[model samples]
Target: MDRYVRSTRRAGGFTLIEVMVVVVIIGILASIALPAYQDYVRDSKRAEAKAALSLVAQRMERCFTESNTYVGCYGGATVNSDSGNWVVSITESAASYQLEADTSAQHSDGECDPMTLTNTGATSPAACW
Candidate 1:
């Protein structure tokens, strides 16, 4: 008796090539998403820094109004204030007065400066204040 042999290959769930293609697609999607997510994080951090800085600016203004003196650059000098993670500093040179907020959480030894709180202005990543 002769036996019949099946020669056609069956369709499986996924092949190696298909799996690899899916992985590559996912990788490409992640690569596109990561930078946008990072930018969002930076923007949120910057917003926090700005809000903290605004509060500090108001406080500095009040201090100035009450004592009638230009407050100098004070770094993280707030004691028992609402702004727990901020270093509020005011610097007045000859004409303009600048209020800066430095972040306690993202405080870098070299890059973390109150005046540079927004990390190279509105174009770069932001530090948490």
Candidate 2:
């Protein structure tokens, strides 16, 4: 009679500890990337505010040149950007004007909540611009 011997061996597969390590690595990467992505989005939205302010300032300048005054320019109304991400308004006089972009309502988390531009083309919160 011939006798057969049985051998015990485990199948190849990922262990729970290995899987957990991979999940932890992914979580760490996500935590690092999420804040960066949010900041990028906020910065891009800020560009919209800056551009809207610039456009309004140009119109105000043209109105001043034509009428010798800033009155009635844009009808003293707040103008919104095409994307509606920013609200732009101007405070003007015969000699000077200040344009502001208010992002509080649309983008409250933005680092530069409110940006300002002057007739002289000066931008505020200097780092943002």
Model 2, CA-based lDDT? 0.82
lDDT of 1 at 88: 52
| lDDT string, candidate 1, 19-82, tens digits | 9999999999999999999777656655666666666556555655676644453433542224
Candidate 1 weakest ten by summed lDDT = 116-125
Local accuracy of candidate 2 as per-residue lDDT tens digits, 31-113: 99999998898888878887888889889989889998887887658888898778887787777888888865646745576
Error of 2 at 19 (Å): 1.4
TM-scores, each model vs. reference: 0.57, 0.81
Q: Which candidate is the best by lDDT?
A: 2
Candidate 2 ranges beyond 4 A from true positions: 1-9, 109-111
Candidate 1 C-alpha error for residue 28, in Å? 0.6
